[model samples]
Target: MSRQVSKKAIRDSKRTFGNQIIFWMFKILYIIYYMLV
Candidate 1:
């Protein structure tokens, strides 16, 4: 049970990390778009 919990925590962290990366990427793109406009 403890192992499963740890596995889930790791998976959740990975998902959050991925989301953070995407968020930053989108922000950068938005800034570039505004600059180009």
Candidate 2:
């Protein structure tokens, strides 16, 4: 049970990091679009 919980936590942290990366990518794209306009 403890092992499973640790695995889940790791998976969750990775997912959270992925989401943050995606969010930053979108923000950067938006800034580029604004600059182009």
Candidate 3:
């Protein structure tokens, strides 16, 4: 029971971390795009 819960928690955290990294990548790209315009 506890093992299943921990696995779910870890998966959720990994997903959130991936989303954050993608968000930052897009933000940086946006800034660069505008700078060149």
- TM-score for every candidate vs. truth? 0.86, 0.86, 0.88
> For residues 1-37, could you state the per-residue lDDT of candidate 2 as single tens digits?
9999999999999999999999999999999999999
CA lDDT scores, all candidates in order: 1.00, 1.00, 1.00
With a 3 Å backbone cut-off (N, CA, C), the pairs that clash in candidate 1 are none
Q: For candidate 3, lDDT tens digit of each residue in 1-37?
A: 9999999999999999999999999999999999999
The residue-by-residue lDDT of candidate 1 on 1-37, one tens digit each, is 9999999999999999999999999999999999999
Off by over 4 Å in 3: none
Report how far off residue 6 is in candidate 1 (Å): 0.7
Q: Considering only N, C-alpha and C atoms within 3 Å, which residue pairs clash in candidate 2?
A: none
Index of the highest-TM-score prediction: 3
The window of 10 residues in a row where model 3 has the poorest summed lDDT is: 25-34
